[model samples]
Target: MKTEQLINALVADIGPRRSFLRSFVYATASGVAFDAVVFFAAIGPRPDIAAAAETWRFLFKFVVTLALAVPATTLAYRLAAPAMWRRCRFEVLMVPLCLLLAATAFELDLVPPSLWMVRLVGSNSVNCMTLIPVLALAPLTCFLILLRSGASCDPGLTGAVAGLAAGAIAATFYALNCFDDSPLFVITWYPIAMSTTAAGGYYGGRRFLTW
Candidate 1:
């Protein structure tokens, strides 16, 4: 075809672009609501809600998860666009990591060296790992479905970010019932669980997100 003809055809094919932000909002909302229902149904909030709420450690958990979720959601939305990779500033994602690291360092300084392992391993390591992924399933599926409506040049990366968002959302819900609030626990196990979901999203994207 002639260059001009091809250009015209391409322009003609360009209908209304899907709104990444809108789709993400709907998917995340649905996922969060689902997580909430599952959480209240199976494992309600920590029994000592009043006591837990008073502690800085408990509150920080929300901060960490929200930190990951908000930026990841933004990044995921941008990544849905073919040329948006350059526009994404990942430094924002580092905020939560730095906060967690600072918190961990403070915790280490206050606690004995021998006890560091105890904090890292926390009581619900297995449960955290298990539940985060399980909770993420609904959100991840929703995110993948919504993402399919966009033009993702880097499907793997987009999916990974979507997974991060899903995992963060799941972790947020899980935090309500989880008794462990140590920075060490959040830094270590949380990432592992989130990474697992991200990996799942990456592979799922490769298999299902192709345009």
Candidate 2:
């Protein structure tokens, strides 16, 4: 076909449905993954909440979560590897932003981190930094699912995805850490994280759409 005809066809094919679906999926996955991961990380080990005097179950579970989260996230990344790899600039900025946010949040007492992990250094900034590295799991999961389904990023929808992804991931992590104890963390940090994710996702989406 001619160039103008081809352009019109392409526009009609992917115009809004793709964008809407992409946003919807990304948001849904963010929420779902966050909830599941948090549940497993915080409550998987503790059967009898009342009987256990020590909250050491979290210690065990935290290690398990990290071990599990890393591989899980890695696999997800690999699945979405093409899109992720394509956004090298996002990845580059993402690392430092993750570090800054995590540290700032913890130094501000955003969430109580793994006990041993927190106490070992005693810097009060360690938890955030440590935690931030793994925060991308939700986004990667969402991204992977999108890529696998052959859905492309929607222009003007990325912020929403990023926000939902970030929020969902934060909620999951906070829920785990706060399981039965950290309500303050849940109430405070979950929203903060989600908002951050939304903002980032939207901005990132804007960038992705442009290229």
Candidate 3:
């Protein structure tokens, strides 16, 4: 083919870029709404939600999960682009992690050292581990769909961040129903559940996100 013809063909293939961040936000919102409906229908908030809301411990769970979700989502959108910014998006993830760690440390100092293990174990370790990922299913699927709309440099990483966002949002939903408000419990099990979904996203992205 002539050089001019090749240039014109390539130009024809180029199209206006879609906004990954906006698409992801819409997808995440849809997933959250779906989860909310399911939650209210089958798994309403804890019976003592009114009372629990008054406590800082109860509020802390939402705050931490939200904090994690925001930055992680931002990073996910960034990863969708071809040229990555040099900024350390991963470092932003540490802010919430360190906050939870600090809260856990404070709680340990205040409570009986002997009961530390009990707090860590909490009452619903099994449930938290199971439900967070279960609840994350819809959101993770939505995030993956959104991720596919973009030209991500690393599909696996993009998917993993999407999983993290899904898990964080799911955990936030679960916290309303969970009776265990201890920082120790939040610090431990939340990450495990998020990690499970993140791994799933990574593999799914690798298998399906290629052009």
Q: Report the number of the highest-lDDT candidate.
A: 1
lDDT of each: 0.88, 0.43, 0.86
Candidate 2 lDDT, 81-175, residue by residue in tens:
23443532334324423443454455447445555344333332233333432464455345533533433345334334444544444434543
TM-score of each candidate structure, all chains considered together: 0.89, 0.35, 0.89
Residue-level lDDT of model 3, residues 1-211, one tens digit each, is 9999999887765533344556767887898998898888888899999999999999999989999988887787778767654543699899899999899989999899899999999999998999999998998888888778778778898888888988898898999999999999999999999999899888878876777
Candidate 1 global lDDT: 0.88
Model 1 stretches with alpha carbons more than 4 Å out: 1-20
Error of 2 at 43 (Å): 12
On the 0 to 100 scale, the lDDT of residue 11 in model 3 is 72
Residue 153, candidate 1: alpha-carbon lDDT: 91
> Higher lDDT: candidate 2 or 3?
3
